[model samples]
Target: MRITKIRATPVAVPYRTDETWAFGSRSGMVSVLVELDTDEGIVGLGEAAAYPSAEIVLSVLKSVERLVVGADPFRIEQLIQRIDVVGTWHHVKATSPAIAAVEAACWDIVGKACGQPLVNLFGGRFRDSVEFFYYVAAPDPDTVKAEGTRATAAGFTTCYLKVGSDSLDIDIERVAALRDGIGPHMNIRIDANEAWTAGTALRAVRAMLPYGLELVEQPVSGRNLQQLAYVRGRMDVPMLANEACWTRYDQLSVIHNGAADVLSVDNQMDGGLLNLKRSAGLCAAAGMTVLKHSLGELGVALAAATHVIAATPNFRHANQAYGALLSDDIVDGFGGGVDNYRDGCLDVPTGPGIGVALDPDRVARYARLYREHGDTEFSFQHPRALTTGLALPKH
Candidate 1:
């Protein structure tokens, strides 16, 4: 059916608590909800990442609404090409993050129309369940050790701890404590959030060697692949490219430079599932492993990632802890998703279109928050910005 109307609405979601990482602290999430209305009266929903409320919402809506107004929403690839042509014609480079939302929503529409799972359309499932690694947020070694132990005990095969805030020695001690607590079997990963210099990363990795870290993520920075490659060459530990590989071109650079052993392809930042598929293909060709990164998205993105991972044989591990971590989730009770620990693996839902329904009340609650508060507490200006967790300043 032809798309008759395209509407973008911004929503603000408050964080239960302030979230802190090496980069910055965030109080809430800004998201833009995309509604694609067709002549047949079918409505499709999609979310975009990297939107800081106002800016990201405006960018995505402007780029997508114009091209998709009168076209057949079923022809997803054709829409992608039109975007490319228009973007290229106008010499635009920052629209991929926004375009991802449109592409994602179209997939949802297709899945809904066919009455089949999105995974079935692309390719059949390879595994019924996916192995997941919990991202530990505690800052201290004792706490890290406790959480690491808890995660392992909770049936998680791996735990990713955030570092780069403390000194290298402190970070090493924390990882060691986690290793000591969890013993030899559980995999331990560290994320520096790109807080280190090349020299610091080398020293940190060397010091952390005894703990058997699976990989160090974004240790030095992603801005310079040459320097990243330099760090990767010297370290025995594998490096995971997170921010460095945002798109196909960046991923190509990572592969060409031999910069990372593992690539963290964020579904949102990497242009959703279709873009991620392309990125995964490139990684496979180069004998690199793909690990889906976490962007605090709800179960929808997580479900989509599971489908993509199932399609890719070379994904070493999946980082999908938010579904279990969120205090109150809209889709938690709808599908047969496992929130509890389950022998270190999460079973993928075999249903269609992300396999979960959004709670209408939850959506309305967020919509109310945005309309009433206007994103002041969350520092967001529009709905899409909240989804990215960018925490923009309020006007």
Candidate 2:
């Protein structure tokens, strides 16, 4: 069916995670819900990650709405090309993030029309479900251990911890405490969020060697592949290129320079699944692993990631921990999908489209929150916090 109408609405979803995010952590996410209506009366839904800057995402969605008003939802490539043309014509670097929502919605439409799940479109399923790591939010070793055990009881297999942006000694102790509390069997990974210098990363990673960390994510800035390669060389631990590999060019550069062992990518960072597939392909060609990242999103992003993860053979380890963190999701109990997570893994959706529906009442409530409360909080934290536990400083 040909496209007839396109609508974008902003929704604010408040959520808390076990671990604090490294860069300007916020209690809620600002996401744009995109709806595409076709001539056949089928509707598709998609969510865009809009954080730190909602206005920019909303503005870009408006621009895209004009471009996609009359286009066919199934003609994803042409629609994507039209976006590229818009970006080139208007010099809009913000094109991809905006397109993320629209593109996902288009995928939803296609899935519904075919009466099959999105994963089926991605070459059937390599797996029935996906895995997710438990994010440890408690800072002190005792608390970390208690929660880590509790998370294990709840079904998580791995633990993801966030490190301070600066100071080697501080992060080393933090990791040591976690290792001591969680014991040896649990897998651990740290996300530094581009907080450290290469020197600090090398020194700190070396110190954390005894803790058995699986990988360190974005230890230094994403700008230089040379520095990442340097850190990877000095430390025995593998590095996951997160912020450094936002685009295909960035991923290609990291591969060319031999910067990282795994690629930590997601729909939000790379724009959408359209580009994420390409990123995964590049990582696969390089024999690298792909781990999906979360923006503390609601169910829509979670479902989309699940389909991608289930369909991808190169996806290693766990994806985002949405089930553990969110007190509630916009579509938690809706008809299509809320994602089935048991024992630290998520089931792939077998329904049509992205396999989820938007609850109008829920969306309305979130939109009201977006209009009233706006962004709840944003902050940075002490890198070397210990017994007192790390507290993020507001921005």
Candidate maximizing TM-score: 2
Q: What is the TM-score of each candidate against the true structure?
A: 0.86, 0.89
| lDDT for each candidate structure | 0.69, 0.73
lDDT of 2 by residue, 143-222 (tens): 76676776766766688878863355656767787777667888888888887777777777777888898889888878
Report the error of model 1 at residue 290, Å. 0.7
Compute the lDDT of residue 23 as modeled in candidate 2: 51
Q: Determine the backbone clash count of candidate 2.
A: 5
